[model samples]
Target: MTITFRRMTPDDASAVTAFLTANRFPFHVNPAPCESSANKRVAEGHFWSKESQGYWVQHGGKDIGLAVLEDLEDDNPVFDLRLAESHRGRGLGVDVVRALCRLAFTELPQIVRFEGQTREDNIAMRKTFLRAGFVKEAHYRQAWPTADGTRLASVAYAILRSDWENNTVTPLEFDDLLLDA
Candidate 1:
């Protein structure tokens, strides 16, 4: 169950293109993506930029997923993760997320927190966030738009660097809306 992360490079274009095209990420607004589009996006460095970097989620010496970590300059960095279709539903999300947390907390020393978001309908991902020690920070209604123009609520989660290092969960205070009599 060895899991590792590899920084993606231009040489990985074909492999990334194939991996993204072959899988259907139903939880995303655009579940089915065309191969050519995927290739073009990868070639265009959609995932790799000055503010962001993409990585290959390798398990047991094989690439099984992709993770794009963004918002590098901010105190809070976020990530987008997608596992291969065959690798989904096998309890790998938590492991991958934990690895992401390690990369964020260690590689980016200035970051105070690491964040991730998923559609409200994506219960699996939400659970994975919880399992990986991310606290539910927000739920924005009608925030995530779909391919057909419909919208779903977007749920946000985060893990503090302190919490990650200490192996603790520091719950957010959500009672700010209480009205005084």
Candidate 2:
């Protein structure tokens, strides 16, 4: 299935709202979001603001998800992806991530890395990150807040431009404790 990305606009508010209302993202901060608020957010440019940009993940001429690109001005941009329920479990996350990498690395030359984070329990997203050539970088304890007023460990992943271009996984050095020798 051919997957593509289109920059989100105000005109896409209805579709965005529908996508959000249709899916129950367990890992998201607000899982059961209302369509009206989703529309308000879209209209207010919450995702597609000066510091960030959003996109519609299209598959077979239909919008299957939304990818919100954050911290665009930074050297490393992060993305929050939410796929529709009907499109989930069909192995589409990896393709969306790969497309994101291409957009970040090729379109934005200044970006050296593209980052993403998911709850520790989100196995599907973790696997998708690895499949898309992203390396595990960090894990923050109780960093992700959920809809039920609880927190979960957030696992960070990133794909360097060099890694994306070269198609390799360059491991990050995390063992930096120089203890008493």
Candidate 3:
């Protein structure tokens, strides 16, 4: 299965709405998004904006998911990746992360690092981040709000441009600084 990323435009609003409403993203802030809400989000430039850009995650020429790269004007850009229900456990996330890194680092020269955050319970995504060479940088407690009025720890992972270029994983020295209580 050949994975590819296609840039999304305003004309693709309907497609984006359909994709969002058709799939259930349990890990996302809004899991089962309503059609009207999806339409509203699309209309409000949630996908395509000055600070954000969207892309279609295609496999074998078919649209399988969506990847929205946010904070484009910033040095560290983050992405939100969602795959179709049928394509979730098929090991497509690593490829999606790679594609996002390629798109950000290769296309945007100003980006110093590429980051992504997922709920603490999202084990698959955490593993995907590790596999994609992203080091765990932060874990904000109760940062991810779910649809069920509950919150989960938001685990952030990032990869520097130097690491990406050298094809290496720069391990974080979390234990370097020790403070006396």
Candidate 4:
């Protein structure tokens, strides 16, 4: 399935919360912060750094997932993305992330690099990030705190504008880098 991201609205709070509640993330369990909480945190406020813009993914006109991103204290972009169970594993993850990165780089003037973090055991996510040109940069032992207070190892990945630009600029006729079914 093909997916795309659209701007998020305060009205999307319920849907975002519902998606998070029904989804099972390996190292996370906090319910989507209360609607009012997310609304307030994601909403514009002087204390909250900067508000995030969320995009609900759609495939063939049906909502299938969400991707949320924002700039934080160090002028770095942080993001979270999820694909519905039925939408995972057919290569849609890379497509969604690319779209998000493109939008982020285009709209955010100060952003030169974009970053994301995921549990080390999340192989699929790591692969998707790599294939989309993000290089795994750091590994933190037991960084992901679980519901039981157990911590899971976490890894962070990043891609800079120059990295993506240089890689894509090279014109290679051979298809070694291409994915095949």
TM-score of each: 0.95, 0.93, 0.96, 0.76
Off by over 4 Å in 1: none
> What C-alpha lDDT, on a 0 to 100 scale, does residue 179 get in candidate 1?
82
Q: Which digits, one per residue and each the tens of the lDDT, describe model 3 over residues 65-166?
A: 999999988999999999999988988889888888988898899999999999999999999999999999999999999998988999999999999999
* CA shift of 67, model 3, Å: 0.3
**Clash-forming residue pairs, model 4:** none
Worst 10 residues of 3 by lDDT: 91-100
Q: Candidate 4: misplaced stretches above 4 Å?
A: 27-49, 72-74, 168-181
State each candidate's clash count: 0, 0, 0, 0
Off by over 4 Å in 2: none
Residue clash pairs of candidate 3: none
Ranking of predictions according to lDDT: 3, 1, 2, 4
Write candidate 4's Cα lDDT for 1-33 as tens digits.
Answer: 555667777676666666655665554434234
The most accurate candidate by lDDT is 3
lDDT of 1 by residue, 1-181 (tens): 9779999988888888888888999888778879888988887786788778999999989888999999887989899899999888998999999999999899999999999999998999999999999999999999999988899999999999999999999999987789889
Give the root-mean-square deviation of each candidate in angstroms.
1.3, 1.5, 1.0, 8.2
lDDT of 2 by residue, 8-121 (tens): 877777877887887888888888789887878778786677778888888999888888989888998898898888889998888889988887787789999999999999
TM-score quality measure for candidate 4: 0.76
By TM-score, is 1 or 4 better? 1
Whole-model Cα lDDT of every candidate shown, in order: 0.91, 0.87, 0.92, 0.71
